[model samples]
Target chain A: MRGIILKDLYDNFCIPKNAAFYIFGALAISIGFFIPSEYYYVLISGVILPLFGCCALKSPTEQEESSSFNKLLITFPNSKAQIVTAKYLLGLGFVILFNFLALLWSMVQVYTHHTIRLTEALRIWGIGISISLLFLAVIYVGFFLLGKRNGTIFFITITCLIAVVWGASSALLGIQTILSCSPGLVICLIFSGAVMIVLSCLVSIGIYSRRYSTGTKNRY
Target chain B: MDYAIQVKNLTKTYKDFTLDNISFDLPCGTVMGLIGENGAGKSTFINALLNITSAQYDQVTILGHDLNTQIKLIKEDIAVIFSDSHYELSFTPLFVGKMLSKVYKNWNQKKYLDYLKRFGLPEKKRLKKFSIGMRVKLEFAAAFSHDPKLLILDEATTGLDPVVRNEILDITREYAKGKDRTVLMSSHIANDLDRIADYIACIHEGKLLFIRAYDELQNNYGIINCSRQFLDTLSPDDIAAYRKEAYNYRVLVSNRQKLKSVFTDVWIENASIEDIILFYTKGEKIR
Candidate 1:
């Protein structure tokens, strides 16, 4: 499993081409610091960071499919469970890294500009992490079930849907009003995201194992 | 005699085709050459043996371990090479070595580096820049570095130049020097098999035709070219397969020496592996 994760990271993250994404992400967060406090969370956490995370999340699957590495992966000593779990763990690692960056940005705002309270910033950070987790869970399930070609279409469709839903909710309820809700709601959202991720991982394992066991030609 | 691989009643079905019930035991310390025509289930059989595809089987034991229940243990001692490289194109040979080191518990880093150096594969060069021959050499380096008891190659030498192919064949011969290692390779190139294989296994249209010792094939199998009257005098038991030409008939017989002595008027030539496969697939069956 560690070997698989390292391969995925080397293929997708630690490469010259992917350096562009990191540069773009950093630039987006830096620009968000100058925006107003209420809009800062929406731009940095909602749009830029999740969008960046989604690209990062989709890369390894695409590369694996293109290179037929998944076929080779089945020959390894690892089981289907370990293979599926490695992808989820990599996603979780990305979510934590992005969330950590968001937290640091919020802290700088709270100390330097005195525009947002630390407590409110923490609340937004928690909500952002939950949303990222849910996004990761859905996209991974799509990649595993639908395969790489159709999964790319699914990814684009889901991204558009999320954008539309976020836009409508922010317009109707306003960002401040939604954030003012009880902390219990954030906790529930985070727990649900965790549960969904676990379910997604299991589904991926079953799909992968069944594909081979049934003698269906693996798409990857 | 001990065996490295024992497969029984193995079958894999698809919507359009099926690899029908096949069974064979590859003895230890010998190279078995798997020969078949296009879409003749050569790769399918290799896939079944490696568990890359799920096939219904009564039993499959490799290197003293059950394939179904002990595949993890079995995989640790076996290495597989396909016609093309399966590693990501962006990966350098150095990265592949590092990644495989973590996957195979018995991976020897020093041996791997030595093989890379010997094969003249650049450690830092990405695979996208590699020639096909170079890519195959890299796979060989990795396969040997792990010290696997069984080496399975599926069309691994399909498109190489003669020199490179001979070099690779020599490496396989060297790898099987001891009585503890085995090699099962499938190839369309019959000459490659004739050069190194200890036994030949031929499959035609999802059926096992024969698995004979290399020496037995050389001494027993013969092709006779004669007139229709001469062919009619031959026994059906001696005729395995034959093709009728415009002027004469070419018959494949199992007993070359006996037929040679009996038929002084006809020309009997020693049959190569290619000739046997051609007759089996394209000629008429007699017995």
Candidate 2:
């Protein structure tokens, strides 16, 4: 499992000779977060970070399908169940890592700038993590169940849907309406999000287990 | 005989194809070569053995463990390599080795590094930069480093140069030397199988045509060139397959010694593995 996590991290994230560029980009984003006037722009980075990590989760499956690396995985000392578990766990780890950073960044921006209160920052972080988890579920379902061609289409469609919802809500519902929701509603949202994530994981596991047992090829 | 792999009534079906009731046993400490043409279910058979497909066999035991119930346990002692590299190309050897070291309980880091060095593989370079031949060698190095009890190679040397192919074959031979290790390799290249396989199992159109010792195949199978009139004198039972060419007949006989005694005037030559496969698969049986 450690092997798979390391392999996925390197395979999906490591780009050659571009370390300085990424470092520079990160530094620029960090600086932007500190500037009171650029808080809105820095929020874009917060959303982008988790999505970027989500994209990394997609690569391992895509590479496996294209390269027949599923064969290699079957020969490993671990069972197929373990392999599936590892992928889901790695994805969960990435989501937590990225969202934690986003939460920290959002808190810092809220503290530095008086435009958004602590409750508003908490609302944004809540929505961000929830959306990220839902999107992660969609991505895995797309790759595992729908397969490559359809999976790509599914991923793109869901992403567009998320974008449209966010855009429409910001324009019509307004940030005040979104942030000023009742605490009870927020608790309900948290419970539903948790249920969705758990259900998605169970569904993903079922799909993977079925595929390994009966599938002729790595459809993912 | 203590068997390394045994299958009984193994069957897998698709709407268009079915690997129907295939059965074969490979004794321990020997190489078994699986030969078949394209779409002949060689890959399907291997996949079934590895439990890659959901196809259920009546019975399958590998290295004394049930393939259905104990596949996870069995997998630890077995190593498999395909014709092409299946690893992510962006990963460097060091990273991959590190990952595998944690994955396999018996992974030997020093032995793995030694193999990489021996194969002239750059430790820091990504696999995408390596040639296809180098990629294959890297897989071989990884397979060997773990010291598996069984090696399942599916066309592992297909596209390789002769020298590299020979080197790979030599490594396979060395791996199996006095270690109670077994190898099951599938190939279209008869020459490769002929060099190392103790037993040859031929598949044609998803069916097991024959499974016999390499020595028995070489010693007993014969190709006889005779006239059509003379071919009629031989019994249909003796002729496995025959082809008519103008006035002469090329017949593949099951018993070389019996055919020789029966037709002393005719020329009977030894049948190569390729000839046997071609005749069995492509030639028509005598009516």
Candidate 3:
């Protein structure tokens, strides 16, 4: 399992060019938002954080298709379920790594400028990461079930779901109810995130097992 | 005889095609060549053996283990190479070697590196930059590095140049020289199989047409070129296929020894594997 996850990371994230582009792009984007100094942290975090999640969502499947390596992956000694589990775990790893880095950077900014309170930044980071987790769970299930070709359809469906959730919660309950950083709300979010991860993991494993067991699609 | 691969009543169906009840056995320590025209279920047959695709089977076993139930255990000792390279384009030989080291328990890093050096592949060059032949060589290197007991190659040499194709065939032949090693390679290039395979299995239209020893085919099959008038005197049962043009008739005989006395005046020559395939697939059957 460690080897499998390592291979996935090696394939998707080990490129120097991609690393440079993301890092430099984030720094350049952050510096470009200089007009409003007070909004610097918010702008940078908003742009880079979701981009990180999207990258996490997109990398493995896109690389699997373009490289034609997924066909070879099944030929490995690992079981089908193991491969799916490794992928989900790799995604989780990425989510954790990205959110942690973002939190650390936010801490540095708060330390230097003191414009944002530590708790406020922590809450924002928590909410953003939780939302990213939910987003990834849905994307992971879609990619596993429909494969790479229906990626656009999956993205559209996810976008619509996000929009519906926002509209319904904001209209019926209140925006504050959804955005509040209460302990109860945080616990609820964590439980739901855990549930989504577990459910997606199982479904993805089933999807991959059926596909590989039947030898249906060779590339994906 | 101890068989390395024993497939029985294997069937796979698509909307328009069905590999119906295919069965054949490949003995241990020998190479078996699978030959077929496009869409004749050659790839499907190979994929079924690898369990890369699911097929209905009464029983399928590889290396003494059931392919369906014990594939995880079986795969450790089996190596497979498809027609195209199945590696990431961005990966170099060094990276691939590192990745595979964890996948195969018997992976020999030294052997893999030796293959890379022998194949003239640079350790740091990305696979996307390698020529098609080089990419295939990389795949072969990886396959060989694991020291698998059974190698399943599906058209692995199809698009390679003659020199590279011959080299690949030689590698397979050497790989099968071990005490228990075996190979099942599929190709339309019958001459390649003729040079290395111990047995040849021909499939046509999703059916196993014939699975015979290579020596038996060489000894029994022959082609006779004679006048149309002389062909009329021969029995149709002896003629597997025939083509008539102008004043002559060319007949492919399945039992060449029997034809010697039956067609005493006709000149018969040994049939090449290519000639045999052409006759079976394209020539008109005598009866």
**lDDT: which is higher, 1 or 2?**
1
Please report how far candidate 2 places residue A99 from its true position, in Å: 1.8
Ranking by DockQ: 2, 1, 3
lDDT of 1 by residue, A128-205 (tens): 777887888898889888887898899899888888877888899888865575678878888998898898888888
Predicted model with the maximum TM-score: 1
Candidates' lDDT values, in order?
Answer: 0.83, 0.79, 0.79
Worst 10 residues of 1 chain A by lDDT: A211-220
In candidate 2, which residue pairs clash? A213-B54
Stronger candidate by DockQ (1 vs 3): 1
What's the i-RMS of each model? 4.3, 4.7, 4.3
Off by over 4 Å in 1: A54-57, A214-220, B264-266
User: Which residue ranges in model 2 land beyond 4 Å of their true spot?
Assistant: A17-32, A35-46, A147-150, A214-220, B261-265
Two-chain complex of model 2, DockQ on C-alpha atoms against the true structure: 0.46
Candidate scoring better on TM-score of 1 and 2: 1
Residue-wise lDDT of candidate 2 within B1-287, one digit each (tens)? 39999888888888989988888788999999999887888888988888877675678889999886788778888999986437777777887789889888899999999999999999999888998888888898888877888899988888889998998888888887856899999998999998899999999999999999999999999999888887788889989899878877899998999878876777789999999999999898876
lDDT of 3 by residue, B1-287 (tens): 39999988888888999998888888899999999888899998987887777888878888899876787888898888888537878888898899889889999999999999998999999888998889888999999999998898889998999999988888788888888899999998888899899999999999998898999889998998887777777788888898876877788888899888876776789998888888888889865
Query: Ten residues in a row with the worst lDDT in model 3 chain B?
Result: B82-91
TM-score of chain A of each: 0.89, 0.81, 0.74
